[model samples]
Each structure stands twice: as structure tokens, then as C-alpha cells.
Target: MEETYLLNVEGVKKKILHGGQGELPKLQDGSKFTFHFQTLKDDFERTVIDDSREAGMPMEIIVGKMFKLEIWETLLSSMRIGEVAEFWCDAIHTGMYALVSRGMRRIAEGRDPLEGQKHRCGMGNMFDYHSTGYEDLDELQRTPQPLIFIMELFRVEDPSAYKRDTWAMSKEEKLAAVPVLHSEGNRLVLRREFAQAAAKYQEAVICLRNLQAKEKPWEDGWLKLESLVTPLVLNYCQCQLELGEYYEVLEHTTELLQKHNDNAKAYFKRAKAHAAVWNEREAREDFQRVAHLDPSMAAAVKKELKQLGERMRKKHVEDRKRYQGLFQSSQG
Candidate 1:
């Protein structure tokens, strides 16, 4: 049945294309939905704005959170799994979506959505004429245009699925989570769970990276985030070293050092990686750099140098013995 109006909310219309399976999932508090959505301008052919299917990643949203450009939640609440529906929403419902779409588009283009401006809430910024830097978004904001949303329901998770993990967090939640994940990684390191520790730190890095994507590079805020990410990255490097992922440690530490030459811990971790990979001269240079950056590490660097020398000498002796034995057998 095509509803002329939503159950409670007015000025919205819903048309069910394909009825879903089983009972409709309740989309009240703590319920989550994973679905693909396509937003379009209500033209003769419905011009495309964004398509989750084209992105190849379905959006998972916590119902009733109202944390995004969400006019579809009310329509989704009445939906069943595997259901397909199209909604025609008025400017009242889609206004916020236009603003949010700007940021998402900016992120897609590798540009900062929050660039060239001070902090403003999404609703407050929606009225600003500065625009979302997207032509389609600008047009939507200029006039009260209705939006066509075609959604395909995927899965619904109950409150038990709300573990508050990385993949299931909003931008604000993600920002708050960075520190918690960093600390968890630190604790895991003390337990010598290198793989697990690396996972935590990696999650932390991803959180910061997502948040940083909205800030203009080389700006004060961006630089501040870079400063914060440096230590977390070096911590991950330490874990990678313990896991014998020497190349990863070297790659990450080298990138860190390029941006931050004064990071002594990065140098030390990289030195360890170089030693593991048998890059003798590079390891020596990094050890020396660490000592120069932080003299307190001199003793530790010396100890590592001793260990590396022992390993290299033992390998050379073994190779020489093997070669000599082969030569003698051939002559005989």
C-alpha cells in the first residue's frame, strides 16, 4: 500500500516497491539498520546525488540517534529486512541532508568539508551561504527541493549489537574513542599481546584519520591532530616490531619521521626493524639518530647493536661453513 503520509510524521510519502521478508524490524531506540540508500533530486528522471550501492558500502546507522542527514530513519523504522522502498521527502525533512551531503561529498573528493571556516553545528551551518562546494547541494539549499530516497533494507541488529566499537560510531563518538583505543593498545602491549595491541592502535589511527579527513591540511587543527597521531603511530610501530612485521614498522616509522624528525621513539623502532631485515648500515644510522635525539636511549641502542652483530656474525659463519663443505665434496 502506498501511504499518502507517514504513520505519525506528516508531509512525507512512502511507496513500497518490494515487500520485505518476515516481520518488520523495530527501529526504535538501540536498534540498528544496515541498508543501501540512493538520494536523488526529484527531477523527471530523478538525478543522482549519492548512491550507497555505487560506493559498495552499506550504511549502518543506530536508529533514533539522529546523528546524521537522517530523514529516512522514520521511513526505515516501518521497513522489513530485504524490503525496498522509495520515499519523497519535503524540504523540512531533506534540508539537513543537503548540508550533511556536502561534507560527505567533500570527503569523497579528498577535500576537507569543514575547510575555510570556524566550527558551526550542522543545522546552524545549513543556513550559511558559503555552500557545500557542490553544485547539486547548492541547488538543493537554494530552493526547498524535495528529495527522492530509494532504500534497500539489509539487516537489523538489536540493542545487543550495540557494542560501541569503531565501525559502529558517529564522528563525535569516534573522536572521543581515539584516546580510549590508544590506551587499550597500551595495556595490550604490557600484556605482550603484540597482534592484539596492533589491532587496537590501528583502530585508533583509523578513528583519527576519519576525523582528520574533515580538517584542512597544515591548518592549526590539522597540525594538532597530526601531533596526536604521531605517538599512536609510533606505538603501533612498536607492536609491529614485536610481531616481526619489520617492513611495516620501517614503512610507518619512516613516514612518521619524514613529518616529525625529532621523534626519538620512531627512530628507535625503525632501527629495530632495519636490524631485523639485515639492513646493517641503515640500522646503524637509525640507532645513532636515536642516541642523538635522546641520549637516554644510548644504552638500549648499544644493547640492540650487540644483539644485531651477534646474529649477523652467526649467519656469516653458517654460510661460510656450508660453502666450504660443498666445495670439499665437489673436489673429492
Candidate 2:
């Protein structure tokens, strides 16, 4: 006969695989818990969905931090340091696991957790992408099911025991950090530190995004936050242009242009990127748009067009000569 201890929370049962020494730690707000976890399907095979140990890092959760998977916090709170326990959580508590895992996986892969969510909220992103780009995660998203989480608690730190990074900050804290980061980025740009400036600007954009995720998509509050993101992204793109990351510039500027068609600066930067990448027709079109949008840029556009014409003409001549030589050699 199998036995399980019903947790204080409903629809959850825990089984201690390995007991830990010492008393239970305080579970105050901001207390950080680091543990290794293996998420398994609650079936006969007990299929593993994710493992933090395999990822070479333990998972972490700060109490009362409003983590997407609230059940993890509850599960962790009931354990002592060095304890290993398995918790079977109902589908209601596990439904958001896929979304949470998607973010974690993206972090592990060194990608933006919000890569495909440039201008939308998290729910909007789920509706649009319809997949986490991972097979298991997508399956889980499609069919919500109960899950077994094997958690090995390792370390727990009090609220003031460690420094808090931006990701751990509250919404108000994040809002306060944005302007400071923006100014830092501007100062770095003034020093000609394009890479460092880009990082700062990108960080500020992320802070805004985190806050924006809480608001409804395209609503007044969300749009207000998005408005703040625009200038920071443009600044980041400017740094990319300086660093010769033309494709990155193109990608960001194109997204910006899609939303704000009248953005002359976006068009101008995109035109420069297109010219650098030898997208002649695209460059010309963007340059023309820039001129039309902001008549003050007419002289600059004219200069760019002259330079582009000269460069393309030289390239064409070189290509024709090379082909002619190849043709003659082949005939001989």
C-alpha cells in the first residue's frame, strides 16, 4: 500500500524521500531558496519533464516574490535545508508550469526570455506563438496534467542575506530603476562605449517589459509602458549600428517601424543597416521614406544616396571584370 502526507494546500500530497537535519527555516517575503528539482509526469512511466541538476544549476525561488509557479514556493516552504521530497500537485497548480519552464529554458539557452514577446503581454504571446518552441513544453501547454516535482532543498537565505538583482525587484523598484539605467546608458554612449551602452539600454527595456507583462495588452497602461520602451530600444539599436551589428539594427528597427510608421529615426537607422548589408532597393526605399517623413533629413538622405550609388557602381564593375576573366579562362 502507498502512503502520502496531504499538504496544507488542497489537491497536493507530499512524500519525503530523504529527510534533512535542523529546523525549518523562516519563510518570509524575499527569503531565497535554492534547490534542484526534477519535474516528472505523474504517470506509470513518471516521465521527466525538466531537471535543474542536469542543467548544472539549482533552481531558485524568493518567497512572496509572485513567481509564476506559486506551488513551488509552497512546496519549498514545507521543507528543511538538505531535504529531498516529491510533491504531487493537481493540474490547477501545474497549469502554469509550462510557461514558467519556457522562461527558465530560454535563460538556460542564453536567450531573451521574452524573445518573441516584443510588444505583447505573456498571455498574448502564448496565444500568438501557440508553442514554447519545445516539444514537451508545447505538449504540456496543449494538455494540462498533474505533475510530480522532486525537489532537493539545498540553501535558504534570509531577505537581507543577499543582494537583489533587477529580476528580483518589485514592480515599483523596477520602475524606479529604469530612468537611472537610461541615464547610465546615455553617459556610456557619450564616452563612446557602444557595447556597454547597448547593455544598459537593453536592461532598461527588460525592466519595462517585466512591468508591462502585468498589464493588459494594448490597453492604456500597457501602451504607456510600451511608449517608454521605444526610446530605449532605439538607443540600443543605435549602439548596434555603431558596433556593425547591421542585422540586429535591421531587426529592431523593423519591429519599431511596424508599430510606429511615422518614426523617422527608425527609418533612417534601418536605411543605414540596409545600405551596410547591400540591400540596395530596401536602403533606397527606407531613405526615401525618411526624407518624406522628415524633410530636415533630405540633405542627409541625398548624401547617403550619392555614396550608395558610387559604392554599387564600383561593385558592379568589379563583379563584371571578375566574370569576364572567368569566361575567357573557361573558353581557353
Candidate 3:
């Protein structure tokens, strides 16, 4: 007689060994099974599409999209009759229904769908996911899963006001009000507002450098300063270059190259500054340094250097001929 067994593999519910007259085997949660069984010659394997409509199965579906059951079929193909398999699915599978439900809730609350999705997906949270506050009508309707889980698990007092206040402040306001200047600097950099961001970065570097200078040479302070100053200096140079402040770019790049002679970006930026000031010799030197430090830049640097040299030689020849002609005319 043929037999069937309902198995709970991981969190997924599946039926194995269909068409049995005997009683089905019950596999409890976290139970392990490993067995080999022979199938009757007449029995044929059947394919079933498991979805939310299927009994004892919870699956997510959108009207137009392909069913995700194909993924489950591929995973199950390797399973032996008695082998117990355990696996995990990501947000695309496990959290799909929850995400859609939350989105629908936002719509019911008179919130824009796009705004609702962003908040539910935790897009606005840069630092701590829990501390990231939300604002507007949409954010007010949603709660982060982790936060809600924590509250439910521990039965903690509702900190609705506290949470609300946190999300109430926009990312811009939060960055500006951040106590650590460097964090605000980083936020600005991420937003591509480099000039305004450079100020905060410069201030942070200065503060750290001062601390390093005050402390003894062997102290941990200098190490911290080195970590902070290097990146900040690089960013400051880049910002100055972007804003067409070539002199400031040269100053920052010069200081950086002093400490890190092998830094390719510093050489490149310094070369740009030199080129801006019509200092071809200095620019060529820096460009050569960059090409040497990073072989990938060699072709571009060689091309620019060749062009610069040709322009300078042509200009020099023209100037010499013009001066010589003037001298001969005066002599005449």
C-alpha cells in the first residue's frame, strides 16, 4: 500500500510520499528525518504549485508577477525521501506578505504608497535602525518590525512619543544637529554637497589634530588623529578642487603627499591644481608621479603631458621668432 507523509522542513510545510493507504507520519517542528524508500513502478510524481490558496501553506503573490513556487521546487529537487532539510529564505520570500500588508495599511491611512514603502523598508535609517525617527503621515502609520517585535516580546511600556520624536526630525535636521561634527560632514558628503560639507570635516580634523598635538607622542591620541585626519584631508582637497579653489586644493594635496608619497589621488589632484595655475612643469611632475603610483592612469597622463608639451613648445617658438623679428627691425 502507498503512504503519504506531511513534513515540516524548516518553516516550510510540505507533503512527501503521496498515495499511501497506511497512516501518514507526523514530523514535529525541529524534528530530523533521514530515510530511503522505494516507489511503486506505477506511481508517478506530480507537481503542485503551492501558494496562499493551498491548504496549510502561506505564500505571497502579486496578480501579474510569476509565482515564487518555482524556487521552492528547485530547492526540493535534491531532497531524499527521508532526508530532513533545513533552509532559510530572505525578505523576498519570507517578508513579502508582511511588506505588502504594511503598504496596504499605509494607503488606508491616507499616505502615499511610495513614501509608505520607503519607511516600511527602513530606507531613511542611516545609523541605528531603531533610533531612526520618521515624520509625515506615512511614517506615523508604520512601525519597524524589529521595534515592534521587541515591544511585544518584552511587554515593555510603549515609547510611542519617544519613537515619534526620533523619526519626526528629518535626515537633514538630524545631521545638522548631530553632536559629532564628522558625522554631519559625512552626511553632507553623501549628499554630494561637498563645499558646505568640507567645513565640518575640516573642523573635525582640526579638533582631532589639536588633541593629538596636546597628548604625548606615545599616547593613543595620535593614532586616532591619523585615522581621522587622512580621510578628512583627502575629502577637503577634493571639495576644493570641485569648487575651483585650486590654491586650497594644492595646499591640502601637498600636505597629504608629504605624509603619503605613494598616494595616487593626491598626486592627481595636485597635478590638476598646477594645470589650473598654468604651471606646466609642476603639473607634469605631479602627473608623472600619479602615473607611476597607479599604472592605470599612465595612458591618460601621457596623453595630457604630450599635449601640454606640444602647446608649450609651439608657444615658445612663436615668442622667440616674434622677439627676433622685433630686434632686427629695431636694428634696421
Estimate every model's Cα lDDT from 0 to 1: 0.83, 0.90, 0.51
User: How are the candidates ranked when ordered by lDDT, highest leading?
Assistant: 2, 1, 3
- Worst 10-residue lDDT window, candidate 1: 160-169
lDDT of 1 at 2: 50
TM-score of each: 0.63, 0.76, 0.38
- Better model by lDDT: candidate 1 vs candidate 2: 2
lDDT leader: 2
Enumerate clash totals for all models, in the order shown.
0, 0, 7
Q: Which stretches of candidate 3 lie over 4 Å from their true place?
A: 1-192, 217-220, 303-332
Clashing pairs in 1: none
**lDDT of candidate 1 over 1-332, digit per residue (tens):** 65667778876888899989999776556688889898988889888999877765777777766656666677788788999998988878887787777766666667886776455666666765576677777887877678888999999988676585554567777878888898899998999998998998888888887678789988988887887798889888888887889999989999989888898899999988999998989999999999999999899989999999998999899999999999999999
Query: Candidate 3 lDDT, tens digit per residue, 239-314?
Result: 7877889999988888878777898888988987887777888998999898988999998888878877887788
- Candidate 3, residue 70: lDDT: 30
Shift of residue 39 alpha carbon in model 1, Å: 13
Cα lDDT tens digits for candidate 2, 1-332: 14476645898999899998799987787889999999999899999999997778888898887887888988888899899998999998888888889988888988988777656544566677767889999999898899999999999998788977778988888899899999999999999999999999999998998888789989999999999999999999999999999999999999988889999889999999999999999999999999999999999999999999999999999999999999999999
Error (Å) of candidate 1 at residue 162 is: 1.6
